[model samples]
Each structure stands twice: as structure tokens, then as C-alpha cells.
Target: MLNLNDLRFFVQAVDCGGFTAAGRRLGAPKTTVSKRVAELETALGARLIHRTSRSFTLTEVGRDFYDHARAALIEAETAEAMVRRRQAEPSGTLRLTASVPTAQLYLADHLPALAEAYPKLHLVVEVTDRFVDLVQEGFDIALRSHFAPLPDSQLLQRPLAREDIVLIAAPAYLEKHGTPQWPQDLAVHAGLLTGPGATTWRLGGGDADEAVEVTPRPRMLADESVVLLKAAAAGLGITCLPEAMCRDELARGAVVRVLPGWTAGSVTTTLLMPHRRGQLPAVRAVVDFLCARLAR
Candidate 1:
């Protein structure tokens, strides 16, 4: 087999004009450099150079080989430098997947700061409700929101935050239907629900907990929390959504929280990554950024 190192030496010898000069440039003995080139030629069964006492010249094959060898060496060096730079600083494309609501409500807003901090990092975000196979799908990280602890999986999960689910309704809806004083009052009002457990709202904080199963008379049934939020704000019905998702509307008084002292449930926001040794700096940077920002 032709040794890449030997090819490198041959290219350096050609570029430096002679074996002695190439040896000095490479910090190797002239005889050692000459011997490696001879081995490379022997491996390829071709005479790559013609030598004299004073100087060396390339054979017809040597000229063609030198051009290719020099280009290869340049490419190899460039690749090494790029990897080293990436190791030292976060620089590369990071692929992330998250639910549409989490992506739109949380990650979408915070990604700009991450980009600003790591200017060399490129982001490819995939937003979908479907659970993706990280290894098969080639995702670097995944952000998920779950009411229940995630089941066992090969992917590593880091809990980012426990987000409260607040019940909200448009002022018009609240005024016309009359505000619900208790969890049971939600049954008579139009309900905008999300996911399979839409009709089942487990409310309250401590021992005062109450489980209210409203009839599935949903005005809107969707997987995305944003859709449910918009429906609630449009006076379609009251819906329970992540507080983070409805913070703006709640502050603007576009939508008011129903049952102020109660919450439906809290979902744990988690960061998921494939288990691997030595995570890339870009991936580590994003993870740390999220943990810092979202944990607040």
C-alpha cells in the first residue's frame, strides 16, 4: 500500500527542490527522506524521481504524481485544521428537533441569543409533534415537554424546567359565560383541549387537589398548544396551556387565567440527546445555553 506520509514527503521534496532542502524543511535527515520516497516508488512500482549527486529531477510519472500528492497533502492539512478549530470553539451545524409548540414558543425566541453567542454555529431545527428516532433521524438534540416522566430510552434526558399548565379564556367568553369559580364549572363552558387527555383536567396544587373530567365537548381538538391557545383567546373556549405559551396574552389581558389558584398540571420540559462520548462544543454550548435560559 502507498503510505500517505511517504507521499507527503515526496511532495515536500519536490516542492523544496531537493532531498537535503526537503529534509531541513521537514526536520528529518536527508537520507531518511530519500529512503521513504524510494519505498513509495517501490510500493507503486514506478520510478517517481531521477537523482544525481548535486540535484534531483522528476520522471514523467513523478510530475503527475507530485501534482496529485501536493493537492492531497493540502486537503489533509486543511481537514485537520478545521477539526482542531471546531474542538477549540463551537463551530458547526447543530440539528435539533422539538414539538411545534415548544419550537415556536420557546426555542424560536431564545435561538437568536445562542446564535449571537456562538457565531460560528449553524442551526437546523425540525419542528414536529411526532416522536423522532434521534439516531435514525440524525438529530443532535431534542426538546420535549411531558406531563409524565419519559419512558426508558437510549437517549439521555435532562429536565430543563417544570412548566405549569394554566387555564385561560378570552375576556368576552369569561364575561358572557361567567367565570368558573371551581374546576366543576368548566364542564358547562365550551372547552378547547389538546392531546388524548383533553377532557381530563387534574387541578389544584397540594392535598386540595381535584380531578375534573369535563365532557369531551371540545370546540377545538389539536396536538399543538399554540392552536389551543389561539382558540381560547378567540373566545372559542377555555383551554389549558403551558404558562410560557400564554404569558404574553395573560399579561396583555387578551386572555385571563381561570381558577387563579388552581392549575391543570405541570409538564416537565426536558432536553434529550443521543448517548455518546465527547459531545461537540456546539452541541454542548446549546445545551448549556438552554439549561441556563429555560431554567429561569
Candidate 2:
């Protein structure tokens, strides 16, 4: 059980040739330096120094210990420097988790720029619809979109974007089933839904908010928004999705917004991290990147 500090003190004393000299160099008392070396000797159960009033000498054991101690101190210092450098610069692997749709549609496109900007950083992204425990899963960060305020948790969250949810369907589906002139007309149409929001479509903005109960049941049900979106794109049914996720599809006429004037509601996109303190440089960099770009 060698104390690293004691080893450092012993090495310094040996290098300086006396406790008094080592103390001056270390900004410590001479007696303190001598005591540390003594404690180090006691811990090793070996006398490391031969002392006289005139000068201090190293025993054979002391010389051997000095060599190893000096090398250890150098290695320890090198490791410290390396970590400090990493802290100053964004480098190393950043583990992030996000919903499948957001990852595929939004994050995928932005990753290239992030890579180019921080060449030292390597990103490992996990895409899943299920909420993951950031601490338990060892994730550096998580990107999540929620309509409601997130449940109380120890993790810190930063709002990245307020994403609007829009109902969309393929042109063929709209044409065959006939377009819904009002939100209630969605009850008769084949609805592609993800999870609990399957039958309940909340529309409008501000004080004019309205809830339309969908009927005839959902034609397709899936846990992933992307799956429901693909089903809607294939002309199976109408589905609601994030505007950002469907931007490309909408632009290319793959999917058209249903009930254009209405919305399912806006969800807050957030960046979740374990704590504000001691965040790795890479994690901080990615968080900043997403917040800046996504907000735009």
C-alpha cells in the first residue's frame, strides 16, 4: 500500500540530495518531506536512507527503490498530462442514444460535419425507441423528443428543439381513401399509429386546441415512428410524424402533410446527460453541436 505522494516525496528528496533541498523545491517543510520519506520506508518495511549530520546517503534498497519510484512518478505524470489534454480538447469515443427516426433522419445527416470538425472524436450512436437508462447503460448522452415535461430524474436535460408533429399520408392513399376535410374524418381512414397516441389525435395550436378520437381502429401499429412513417409512405394508412423526420419525404412527394393547418402537438427535443460536472470534452462538444444546429 504505497502512497503515490510519499513515493514522489522520496524521489524528490533523493534527486535533491537532502530533505531540506526537496522541501524548498516542493514548497513543503523539510521535516514534512523527511516524515513522508520515513512513512514510505515504514510502508515498504525497508530503510531507504542512511543519514549523517553532514549528508544523507541511499542504502542499496533505497537506490533500487529510487529507480523504480522515479520511473513510476514519470509514468503517473505522463498519464495525468494525457488526461488533461483530453479534457482541454474534444477527443475519444462519445456514446449517444436516440430514437430510431431522429437518428436516421436528423442525426445521420449532421454526423459528417461533426466528424469533420472534431477529427479526434469518434461517435458511437445507438438507435432505439425504448427509453434507456443513461447511467445504467453507460451512455454518454441521449437525444429524446417528448411532448410532456420529462419525468423527474437526476439527469440534466437541455432543450435542443421544439419539433412539430404533423400527420402525413401518401398521395395515392389520400386519393383512394378521399382526403379528410376535418380532423374527425380521420376516424374512418386507415390510421398508422405508434404506441398510445394511436387513437387520439390532438390538433391545433394555442387556445384553439382540439382532440379528435380516431375510429375503425389503426390499420398498423408499431413502436417506432419510422416504421409507421414508412407504412404511411407505402399508402397503407395515414401516420403522424415529426416534421424534421419527414422533410425529405415531403419534399420529394413521397408523403404529403394531412390536415396541414393542424398538428398533433409539438414535442421538445432534448439532450440528456448524467451530470453537468466532469462531462467529457467529447460529450460537451456533441451537446453543443446538436443544440446549435438543431435549434436552427
Candidate 3:
């Protein structure tokens, strides 16, 4: 019989890129993880890993087995989530990460309610614009906005909110440079762009996605969404930002929307967590709280 725990260790080893890394994630000694893998391979009479002094690579047979092992783990996790769903309450430490603005605007306002509802739940929030390694960073959940879908299946994602990227500028800048009527006019105007994916922004209407390449003058190139927003508000440059990020500013007339007809769609927020079985009560609680709060 295949030991599921050993299979999990194998998957972790592959994901973390080494036996020592897998051991750290599983909180086991490196030798223990190594021995369990060796034992599993011996029982099956097959070589699963192509090991070297510096690295480990999977063989064809190892890849095949990994697929099955990964599926089994996902199913087990789903089952455990079902069980946690039946319980009326949640408790424990919930480590979470999010962009600085989202944390300030959404989570900071909402997480207290969740914590209050579940007194035993302790919430730790890490706010940053940079990508975080969830497992390595010891985070239970992360909230992010991306133009593209997260490409990894090893992390389960739950969509929290649907948002749109709207062109924003101070009334002064629009008056000075004249507002851009179409995507093409953006080339002539001073603009701000978010950096993460590629530097290109997809701008268009309906189902036909149009890619427009713009070279914006950078007083400073901001990697952080909040900083980008502040620059736009100060009338430094026009920017396309998530609607959620600029809601308060738009409402207050600090920044006004431009190019209503020609808009870009790059706004999506999701809760991401490690694809694991038997998440404890506190983790599940934080997930539910975030889903509900963001949904609203």
C-alpha cells in the first residue's frame, strides 16, 4: 500500500525543489523525508527521483506518479474542507497577505469583525505589493490583483471580488493634456502603468481584447498600486487602476475617471492558500470571512 504521507512529502519535495526544503515545509528532519522517499521507491521497485549532489529532478515515471498523488491530495483536502464547513465556528492563527491598499481599504476595516466573531481566531496580516511565497513565508492566505489568472494549480484560489481597471487622472491633467477619447490617444498623454506582469496593457471593448503599447514618461515608476494611485491623485500622471483601489478617491473627486468608453480589464482579487488537506478551524474561518467580506 502507498503511504499517502510519503506521497505528500514527495509532492512537497518537488514543489519546494529539494528534499531539505520539503522537510522544512513538513516540519520533519531532512533525513526522515529522504528515508521515507527511498523506502517508497524500494517498495515500488522504481526510481522516482534523478538525484544529484546539488539538485533533484523527476523521471517520467515519477511525473506520472506525482499526478496521481497530487490529485489524491486535492480530493482529501476538499473532503476535510467539507468537514470544517459543518462546524459552526472557527479558531486559531490565520496568517494572511495582501497588497498594501487592499489591506488598508478592505481587510483592515473588515478583519476586526471576523476576529470579534471568532474570539479564538488570531489574524496576522502582511501587506506588500511584491509576490510572496505562501508556504515559505508561513502564510495561510493571500489576496492579490492580477491581469492574468494565477497559473499554479498547487494553490487553491477563491475569487473575492470582480473589479475593472478604469483610467484615472486629476481634472487638471485632463484639462492640460486634453482627455484621451480612445486607447490610441494615450500615447500622447503622460501616463502611469502598473508593473508586475509585462509592461503591456490590454485595452479594448467587449470580447475582442486589444493590446496597446504605451511609453509613459516616468517621474517615478511605481511597483506599488497605492503609490501609483497617490501619484495620479497628485496630478503627476494619468493611471489605469482597479476600481476598488480608487473608489474613495473617485467618490471624493480627488481623481476623476477618463476614457469611460475605452477601458482596460485587469482587475481581479482572489484569496489564495496552499492546496492542503485538513486545514485547521482558524484557517477556514479566515477564508470564509475574507470571501464574505470581499463578496460584499
On TM-score, the leading prediction is 1
Error of 2 at 63 (Å): 42
| Winner on TM-score (1 vs 3) | 1
| Candidate 1 vs. true structure, TM-score | 0.67
- Candidate 2 TM-score, C-alpha based: 0.66
Residue lDDT tens for model 3, 1-296? 88888888888887788899889878999998898888889888999999999879999999999888877876776666567657745655568899877687668888778878888667788898788988656677888866688787678888888788888998888887788776767767776766644345567673445666555554446677888899899888788887888989999999998877656776677788886622655676677777777777
Model 1: clashing residue pairs? Answer: none
TM-score of each: 0.67, 0.66, 0.66
Q: Model 2's lDDT to the true fold?
A: 0.81
Per-model lDDT: 0.81, 0.81, 0.77
Q: RMSD, each candidate, Å?
A: 14.7, 14.5, 5.1
Lowest-lDDT window of 10 residues in candidate 1?
Answer: 205-214
For model 3, the superposed segments whose C-alpha errors exceed 4 Å read: 1-5, 71-88, 91-108, 118-142, 148-159, 171-221, 259-266, 270-288
Please give the lDDT score at residue 4 for candidate 2: 96
Record all residue pairs in model 3 with backbone atoms less than 3 Å apart, i.e. clashing: none
Candidates 2 and 3: which is better by TM-score?
A: 3
Candidate 2: where are CA atoms >4 Å away? 1-88, 195-197, 205-209, 276-279
